[model samples]
Target chain A: MKKLYTLIKNDLKLIVRDKTLLSFLLLPPVLIIAFKFLTPILVETAPILEEYRVIIGMFASIQTAIMFGFVTSFLILDEKDENVMNVIRILPISGFYFILYRLLFATVFSSIAAYAMITLSDIAHPGNLEAILLAILYGMTAPTISLAISTYAKNKVEGMAYFKGIDLLLMLPIASFFVGSSLSMVFSILPTYWVFHFYETSYNDAPAFEFFAVGFCFFGILISLLLFQFRKRVFGR
Target chain B: MIHTKDLYFKYPGAAQNTVNGISFDVGAGEIFGLLGPSGSGKSTTQKVLFKLLSGYQGSAQIKGKEITDWGKELYSQIGVGFELPNHYLKLTALENLAFFQSFYDEGLDPMELLKMVGLEKDADKKVGEFSKGMKMRLNFVRSFAHNPEILFLDEPTSGLDPSNSRILKDIILDLKNQGKTILITTHHMEDAEELCDQVAFLSEGEIKKLDSPENLKLEYGKRTLEVRTYGSNEPVIFDLDQLKDDKSFLELVQSGEIKTIHSKEANLNDIFIATTAKK
Candidate 1:
């Protein structure tokens, strides 16, 4: 417990010192404020946007989660750039445990940020239970981004390029809402599609449990695979 | 406290072993040096001993237990100072020490460690702003901040000025007096001569020669002496074995006319070159 506290505290200091990461601390409140004011204006302007307010709300929350994921991934890239992991490998704490702790920290932060974005936006008007489930699913996005960046990118320059590509993939789930259910299944291979499917089914009063189960399984498998690649490439395990 | 027998290590997919059939023991309170040029397996041997690299086909023990049998607890008893200084560059020196200190149950005070390395005044300053020598000094002391029983230092004095190097060497001697075994890998012959109780001249992943500094000099040095008397521009050379039977040599010494008398003993640089040179 003491070791974990120390590690987290050290990470916090690094975050505060980094200008790029410091901006992420304000990202949630800034985006939330922007969404709060802009949603009603968009509805007033198009009136067709009224039908897509829930999707807009969902986009806002997922975007917040993705941004938090970027924060954590950049933190990891900073450590890799400085070769801090090599020093940590010799310590009593295992490198896997340290990474687990970072993911957990990011998950909690992203979950809370997503929940705040969802509840404050007035567009996604979800029930308490649905909101909790969506928040949990959104939280998983943080670690997925962290693992993907660590596995594929060697430094921050490459991380930025890889992250832009990943951002395009994360948005693929939005295409499912426009297409039919049978056609939407084509996007099921992506983990984010299932997350959006769970939200869509619950909002439409359809069976949501299967989507939740499939979403979690995909999240589990993708996270596991990414973790494996991350361990092998980053630590040479 | 450390022992290895016929240790051999070959990297995965490599053609040959990097550490090949080498054996040595480092007792408690002793300093052992693995001296070699690049690619001589000095770092590889240290990695195998520290459990960083596995799949060795020989017996290796640390503190009387097989290295493979030990867990992460082994790290608490053994500290490693890498050849490159690895620190959280954005964090202050004090914070860096405190963060690493949290990994162990007990560690020396961060302030004291910084003071020992002459970085106390810069404790609050970020490491990224430090000079290479300052970072190297900090890297040297960080190895034993946990007060480990054994220390592995690679190029500990590399990149330091003479004054700083002397300070680090003095601290190492102090640690030795406190009964901690130290293993150092360096290319600097002066470091090997001044710090090591025993040194192994490693070349191409093999131990070519191993002995004390004095003994190596005796075994490989010239068996003669040179004498220069005042008023004579030319020096005279005599066989060291027959110096006592040479009247002229004795007469110059007895008459107090000898300006300088020097024995031709090999230094570690000459010995290192001679031993590691391809036969």
Candidate 2:
């Protein structure tokens, strides 16, 4: 338990010191705020812009999810490149504990970012508590999927390559929403798809709770298994 | 205590074993040095002992039990410092130490460790800003922070200045005196000569010679003496064996004509080079 706390604390210190984290966590929130205020002025003069709120909201959620995914992937890749895993492996702590810390950190950071984005946009005004909780749940899943992909990555460059490839595949489900298709069944298989579905349904008049619960349970198990397999292969017991 | 018998390790796709079927024992509180050149399997030996690499072919034991039988509990008693300094570059030196110190049950004081390594003033500086020597010193302190019973240090003094190197040597000696078993791997003959109780010369994944520095030197050194004398305005060399019982040799020595007289005893470097070169 102490070792896990140390690892998590160390990671948090580094994350706080990183300039990139600022750009990653703050930039999207700032952009959403800018778009929120700018849309009113532009839409008053141009009637075509008034009907694009839902599209903008979807775009915002997708953008937020991708940013979250990139941040989680890059963080794991950085640690791997620095041989931090090797250092951690020599410690008396279990692999499960080390991974749990990382997952928790990523989830908390992602949740904060999600809440900030929603609060800034002011379009989907779910109460602060519901928004925070839903974001936390969704945020936790991103890092698991990203970390699982990182297992096959040998270095940062390769990890980024795989991350981008996976991002494209994941974006397919989000893209389904823009096309006005009800493809929750297909999106159910992709963890990010459920995250997007959860966000869209929570604020708008849609069935998000049922989809969120089912998607959370399903991906939760799958990702846990994938994380275990990864931990075994990369850091043998 | 460490014991290995017919231990073998080969990296995947390698043609020959990186570590051949070699056997050795390191007793408690012993300073065992693995002396070898690059790619001579010294580091590989240390890695195996530290459980960094697995899938070996033979038996290895630590603390009177097989390595395969040991659990995470074994790590609490062991510490490793790699050839290269492994630290978070963005973190201050203090933060780095504090982070690793938290991994162990009993840890040395980070401030005292930094002071011992002569990095006390730079504790707040980021490790990325440190020079190679500074980084090496910090690496030395990191190994001792856990107060481990067994220490595996690879090239511990590779990049330090003389004074800092001496400090590190003193710390290693101090640890040894405290009854800690230390395994040090280095190509520096002087380190083995000055610090190790027993040194092993490794080449091509095999130990060429293993013994105390004094014993190895005595065993391999020449028994003859070399006498240098000024004769007719020129220096002349006389072999001790050639004048063993000669009256003229005594007369020469008594007349003070000899400029210098010294036995030809091999140093640790000579023995190391000769032994490893042969293999």
Candidate 3:
């Protein structure tokens, strides 16, 4: 427990020191706000402005998640490239605990970024406790997927490549303006797509418990297993 | 303590074993050095000892039990300082130490360790701003912050200037005095000569020679003296063994004209090069 606290503290210190955190955490939401203001200028029609607002807002949320996910991957890759992983590997700590510490750190950062985006856009405020809980749940999924991707990357450069490719595909559902709304059903399998769905659906009314619970359980199980396999294959006993 | 017998390790897709059948033992409070050139399997041997690589043929015992039998408990008693500095550059030096020190159930005081390595003044400075020598100095003390009973140090002084190297050497010797068994791997012959009580010369996945520095030198050295004397305004060299009991040799010595005399004993470097070069 002491070790976990130390790891989390050190991770937080490092994150705070990074100059890129501002661009990563704040820039996406700022860009979304800018787009929201410029929507009328780009499209003088109210119908087009409404469509643009929804598309930009959805894109903003996913951009936030992907940005935060990439940050987590870069951090883990940096540790691996610097041989910090090897140093910790020789310690008395279990692999499970090591990864848990990283996951916790990433989750905290991603949550902050997610909340900032939600506030800036003022689009979908999940006011109730259940809605808020689901938002937090959505935020936690990004880091787990990021950790899984990092396991396959050999270095920072490769990690960025993987992040870019994966982020591009994951961000596709938000491109509904260009790709057509017919594709949303196809892309809904992606976690970010579900995040957008949950955000849009929650404001109308509390989502059906079955919808949130089932989606949460499925992604949760998948991420848990991915985290386990990543720990075993990349960081062997 | 460490014991390995017929240990073998081959990298995936490699044609031959990186570490062939090699056996050695490190007793309590001993400094054992594995001396070799680059790609000579010195690092591989150390990796196996630390259980970093598996799929080896043979057995290794640490602290009187098979290494495979030891669980997470083994790591609490061992510390490893890698050749490359492994630190979070964005973190202050103290933060880095504090972070890693927390991983162990038993950890040394970070302040005392930082002070020992002369990093106390810069404890709050980010590690990215540190020079290579300073980084190495910090890395040296970082390994011991867990108060490990055994240590594995690879090229402990590779990047340091003479003064910093001396400081690190003193710390290593101090660790020895405190009864911690250490295994050091390096291509630096002088480091091995000065620090290691017992060293093995490795080449091409095998040990060419293993013994104390003094013993290896005695075993491979000529054991004869070469004398230089002035003969007709020119220096003449003669082996001491060749002039034994000769009247001329006695006359030259009695006349007090010997310019220089040196024993033909080899230094550790000479022995290391000679033994490894043969393979």
Candidate 4:
């Protein structure tokens, strides 16, 4: 626990020092604030848009999760660029645990941010337990995308390209609502689709228990596969 | 303190083994050098010992346990200094040490370690701003920050000037005095000659010669001595074994007319070249 604390403290220091990463760290809050203010204005300007607040809220929350994942991915890439990963592999705590801690930290931070964004935006009024579960389910996207970017990208430049491409794809699940029923079912393969569906069901006064179960299974399988790939590629384990 | 016997390893999809059937032992309180040019498997051998590489065939032991048998705890027992300087460029020198030091249960003071490497003044300066030599100094000192019993140092003086090189060598020797076992991989023949008690000359993943520097020099050196008389600019060579019976050489020495006499000993560079060239 002490070692994990030390790692977290060091990462916090690194994030605070790097301006680019600091901006990413600050982006989620800015996004939440922007959504909080902009939603009411849009509701006032076009009362018809009031019914689409859930869609608007989905953009902020999901984007916030993606942003957190990218932040952690950039940190991993920085460690690689600096060749500190080699030094880290020889440490008593080992590189595997260090990365595990990063992924978990990103997941937890994104969950809290998602909760804040959803509740503060006043777009979704689910009970506390339901809201927390939905936010936590959405949060799994953090580690999934984090591992995906860091696993495939060899450097920060490549990481940015992957981040942008994955960012656009993550938002694609929302497009399922505009498509035919059969086409909508096709989006279920994407882990984010279940997250989006779960949020949609919960906010619309329906039990999202089924979406939560499916999302957990989808994220679990994808994350496990990515973790294996990450270990093989980065640590060569 | 460390032992390897017929150890072999091949990289994935490689044509041949990078470390092929090499073996050696390093006793406690001794500095053993693996001297070779680049691509000669010096670093690969070090990696196998430190558990960075796996699927290696044959046996390697650290402190009486097989390297494969040991887990991450093995890292706590050994320190590694890589050939290249690897540090958090944005972090201060002190921060880098402090961060690495936090990995161990107990570690030496970061400031004292910085002082040891003459990096105390630059402790607050970010590593990206450091010169190559300064980073190399920090790399060398960081290996033993946790006070490991064994050290693996790869090109410890690679980027340093002569003064700094000498300082690092002195510290290595000091570590030897303190009963620490050190394995160094360097292409610097001068370092091998001065610091190593025993050196293995590696050529294409094979040990061409393994012996003390003095013994190798003696074995490969000329079996004669050169004497220069004060009056003559020309020096005369005499067989070393017959020095006692050479009355003229003795007379020259007795008359104080001998300007200098030196045994024709082969230097480590000559020995390395001659040994490796054989392959």
RMSD of each: 2.1, 3.8, 3.7, 2.3
Question: What's the fnat for candidate 3, on a 0 to 1 scale?
Answer: 0.81
Per-residue C-alpha lDDT of model 2 across residues A1-237, encoded as one tens digit per residue: 666566667766776777775466566677677767876777788878566555555456545645655666666666677666676677776655766666666666666766666667765555565577566655655666566666778886787688778757656666757564655465656766666666667667665677667667766787778787777667764
* lDDT (Cα, tens digit) per residue for candidate 3, span A1-237: 665666656666666777775466556567657655665555565555554454555566666656666667777777887778887778776756766666766666566666665555554455555445555655666765577677888887787678777778766756543556786578767655665566556645655455466557666876777787777666774
Instruction: Give the TM-scores of the predictions, in the order they appear.
Output: 0.94, 0.85, 0.85, 0.94
Interface DockQ of candidate 3: 0.69
Give the better candidate number (2 or 4) by DockQ. 4
Against the hidden true structure, what lDDT does model 1 obtain?
0.88
Pairs with backbone N, CA or C atoms under 3 Å apart (clashes), candidate 1:
none
The Cα error of candidate 4 at residue A111, in Å, is: 0.6
Cα lDDT of model 4 by residue, A1-237, tens digit: 788788888899888889988999899899888888888888999999888777887788888877789889989989888888899989877688888888998999999899998888787656677779878877888898889998899899999999888888888999998899889998887888988888888888888889989989999999999999999999999
lDDT of 1 by residue, A93-152 (tens): 787898888898888889898888888777775667877888888889999998999778
The chain A TM-scores for the candidates, taken one by one, are 0.95, 0.77, 0.77, 0.96
Interface RMSDs of the predictions, in order, are 1.0, 1.7, 1.3, 0.9
Point out where model 4 deviates above 4 Å. Answer: A46-48, A126-128, B226-236, B243-261
Please write out the lDDT profile of model 1 over residues B121-207, one tens digit for every residue: 999999999998998888887889999999999999999999999999999999999999999999899989999999999998899
For residue B27, model 3's alpha carbon misses the true position, in angstroms, by 0.8
Q: Which stretches of candidate 1 lie over 4 Å from their true place?
A: A179-183, B227-236, B251-260
Candidate 2: clashing residue pairs, number: 0
Q: Highest DockQ: which candidate?
A: 4
